[model samples]
Target: MTGPETDNESPETDDEPPEHRRYARYLELLESVQEADEAGLVAAVLRDDCVAMAESAVNRHLERRAAQLLTDAHFPDWARTTAAVIGDRAFLSRRLREWTLLRAIALDEPWTAEEVTGASDWFQRTAAAAQAVSSPEALDLLAEHGRTRRVRNAATLRLRPPRRRPG
Candidate 1:
């Protein structure tokens, strides 16, 4: 049975580029996040759609919004915690780092090498690897010393190859 199409349900036309379609949907998701009540916000954050955005300006904005949504005290603890737990599953199971999940745990704050060392939880430690490119040393520390296998694995995956020493 066909239902009336709403703005959010607009069908993609043949001419639309995939990237444009994805970005359009990403914008809609952002608007939904803003309008959603606490429960709705949590649900949106944990949705596969939110996790599926490609790395781009749209995804970066989503990460920022999702991070804020997860940490906002106005939301109920169970709601925030539920999203974080689910996001963690997504982060850990995926072959690559899920920036949205990573940013959420880090509260969208920058993680210094020292802060990564001081992180109190696995998520913090894992997200700390976002700095791996900038600070391979920090990831080296985690790869060797992280308390958990998952943290160690996450760090190891992001580490840069050791430089060759000139003979």
Candidate 2:
């Protein structure tokens, strides 16, 4: 009998559409979570893996929520894959941690200090924008500007050029 490892070929090649494929996987997970069977645990594990793969696909682009939904799914296997894909590591960039925090809240996952480290300067300012609001109206005004989304602390600051152009 061939063992599980016998197959030399890898699964989920680059050609697959991970986004579309994940729905079927999540359906299986939903059933298993409802049934609480050993199969369900297996389904969840597989679903998490699928979510991770899907996130990596989304991560290659500048997309936010699409990638985050994979994380917001809240499986460790999934969330671990949802972070900003920087060199050799992944995370919510300093410019984007608030979105991650808000997402964590929406998902009922609390933000951890470890995840909050290396926060971008933009994150602090955006947090303050929300914090500076004292009344509902102010928040509403900001919200009108799509400010409900995480505001950048300072990713836009620019330096002035010198007046002289040497000839």
Candidate 3:
């Protein structure tokens, strides 16, 4: 049965660009998901719509807002710890660094202590690599390192069992 259309239920018109559509969707999600628990908010961020919005965001304000939302969202201790490690890396662009760290936290499941340590070690190595390079190359190297570290961590987390709480 058809229900009355609400403001958010309206579909995008044919003329709207995909980026604009995604941005609108992200805004809607952001409003509705604000009160969601950490896991729920992380799940929202990981949705295909949100990921597309994040990747295609051309407006600096919007991008920064989205990163702030992810950072403010409740995350597990391990994810927060890993994010702190990533945040401390030198020679990385603050925007890219924070976004990448938030993305890692969003993707994180129940993580082991060893896995968290591995992420910290990876960021440390990446920071060292950045330090070894020229200024311009350092930023590029750090960005590359961030991407590589996130990919490796995602793979590792996928293979490891989810952490169990003490009964």
Which candidate ranks first by TM-score, i.e. highest?
A: 1
Ordered from best to worst TM-score, the candidate numbers read 1, 3, 2
- Of the pair 2 and 3, which is ahead by TM-score? 3
- For model 3, how many clashes? 0
- Candidate 1 lDDT score relative to the true structure: 0.48
Report how far residue 69 has shifted in candidate 3, in Å.
8.8
Instruction: State how far residue 12 of model 1 sits from its true place (Å).
Output: 10
Model 1: which residue pairs collide?
Answer: none
lDDT of each: 0.48, 0.37, 0.40
For 131-150, candidate 2 gives per-residue lDDT tens digits of: 32223332232333332244
Model 2 stretches astray by more than 4 angstroms: 1-62, 65-76, 82-87, 90-100, 112-118, 122-167
Off by over 4 Å in 3: 1-12, 38-42, 49-52, 56-167
Clash totals for all candidate models: 0, 4, 0
Selected candidate, larger TM-score, 1 vs 3: 1
Tens digits of per-residue lDDT, candidate 3, 79-154, equal 4433443344342234344344434434442323332233544443433342122233223333444346654444
**Candidate 3 lDDT trough over 10 residues, lowest sum:** 1-10
**Model 3 RMSD vs true structure:** 16.5
Off by over 4 Å in 1: 1-13, 17-23, 32-51, 54-62, 66-72, 75-89, 92-115, 118-167
**Model 2 score (lDDT):** 0.37
